[model samples]
Target: MQLFIGNINGQFGELEAEETQHFSRVLRGKLGQEIYLTDGKGTLAKGVVTEIHNKSIQLELSEIQENFEQRPYFLHIAIAPTKNIDRIEYFLEKATEIGIDEITFLKSFHSERKNINLERCQKIVNAAVKQSLKAYVPKLNDLTKFTDFVAQDFSETKLIAHCEEDFERKNFKEILQPNENYLILIGPEGDFSLDEIKLAEENGFQGISLGHQRFRTETAALNAVFGLDWAN
Candidate 1:
């Protein structure tokens, strides 16, 4: 099915500018042709191409389906933004495709990148959601300090991925409880400092290993995502 992204709330609506390009140039949607749209908020609406303009296309909704079985549990990944912006973007796209509810770029003591292109990241995730045919858009939160992020009241199974060999960690399969919200922490290239790790532990974030192999920040974040998917 050709899935477009838009809102058809009151019987009629128009595709957003970014979506208009796909409607005309990529999909070549024709008037009267049936199309599908998701608000990326769990609602999928069936609509027909009503009018094709130069830059925007009008749509009329016919039917709507709400997704209720969106992952029984929440998987929120909080990771330090990689030095290379592309690396973080790669992780964002892949993780969104795989399935994620929330993502937060963190500012860590060892982190190289302080801020990320919020708008760009949003577009990447939005495109991934449509490409992967997902109804819910994984939210991209503002960059947060490591200590501040961990201190917040989060889901039951809060985990922090680290490369320290001395730290006691367990496989997610052995620790994760199904159907409960989860918040995972992934550090940067330099990894988390001893103090930051301790802070997380104090905040009830358990140490979790993504296996023995050392992984980059992006890889570790994606690994955490797959780990939760497996547990689910």
Candidate 2:
């Protein structure tokens, strides 16, 4: 199925401006041709092209599916952005394909990169969702301070992945419960500072380990997402 993102209401919908060129010009979509549409909010529809213009492509919806392929578990990963933006973007794309619900870029004491382009990251994830045939789009949050993020109340299972051997840490796989919401924290290249780990523990976050081998900032974050995904 060739899926495009759009808002569908009742029996009609219109593609966004950016998608117009791809659908009408690039793809050479013709009037009366059938196409798929998704709102990235668990709504998928099959529609026929009704009108095609420079700014938009209008569709007459025929079939609609709600909660399309919704995952049973919710996985949210908050990690420090990598120095090389490509690595973090790679994580976002892969995680979206492997199934992730939300992401947050962290600003920590040991963080190498303190900023992120939310727009670019969102585009990567949106493309991944369509490529992977997923109806829901993962939520992307702006860079947040480590202290402030840790202090927030979350009902999901909270975990912090760090390499500090001095602190007792549980295996990430063992900490997961099927069909439950999870929020995991991955640190920077230097890993989370001891004080940061201690502070997170105080805020009801448990420390977790992703096995013996050490992974990069982006790798560890993806590992956390994959671990929860497979566990469920």
Candidate 3:
């Protein structure tokens, strides 16, 4: 089914300028063609085209379905932005496709890149949601200090992914529980500092390992996402 996106209240529908042009001039959808519209907040509506114009496409809702499954519990991933922005963008695309609740870019001591293009990241997320046929849009947070992010009152299950020796570590899949909210910390290329891990532990974040092999920033983030899906 072709899914279009709109705001939460379903007041105004949105289509990219290109999409509007294509639907009007290229595909030429008729007035009665059925289409699916989503608010990106778990609300899906079955709509029929009412008008196809150059600037906009109008639809009349016939039926609506609300996804009330409680979102499979929240999965919030905090990671350092990669030096090469493409890798982080790729991770965001795949993570959204696989179903993550929120993403935060942490400013770490060992982080090489300190800045992120929010606009570019949002575009990637939007495209991924359309490709994955998902109803909810994952929340994207601005870059924040590692210490500050670690100190927040988060979900019940909080984990820090670090490659340290002292702490007793388990694979994320082993630690995660189904139907419970989770927050994971993924570090940058140089990984988290020993002191940072200690601070996180002090703040109630459990240290967990993705696996034996060393992974890049993006890989680690995606691994955590996989772990969450497995647990769910």
Q: Which predicted model would earn the best lDDT?
A: 2
Error at 89, model 1, angstroms: 1.4
Q: Relative to the true structure, how large is the alpha-carbon lDDT of every model?
A: 0.84, 0.89, 0.81
Candidate 1, residues 1-232, lDDT tens digits: the string is 6777776576776777788888888877789988778877787777888888887888888677787238878888998999999999999999998889999889999998988889999999988987888878899999999878888887457888887777778876677777878888889999999899889999888898877787888888888778767777
What is the per-residue lDDT of model 3 for residues 1-232, given as tens digits with 9 covering 90 to 100?
6766664345435455555665567766677787677777887777777677777677777566778233668888999998988999999999998889899999999999989988788878977887777778788999999999888887568889999898767777666778888888999999999989999999998899888888888898898788777767
Query: By TM-score, how accurate is candidate 3?
Result: 0.87
How well is each residue in 56-159 modelled by candidate 2, as lDDT tens digits? 88999977889998889888899899899999999999999999988999999999898899999988998898898888989999999999999998988898
Of 1 and 3, which scores higher on lDDT? Answer: 1
Off by over 4 Å in 2: none
Clashing pairs in 3: none
RMSD of each: 2.2, 1.4, 2.7
Task: Give the Å error, residue 109, model 3.
Answer: 0.5
Candidate 2 RMSD computed on C-alpha atoms after optimal superposition onto the true structure: 1.4
Give model 1's TM-score versus the native structure.
0.89
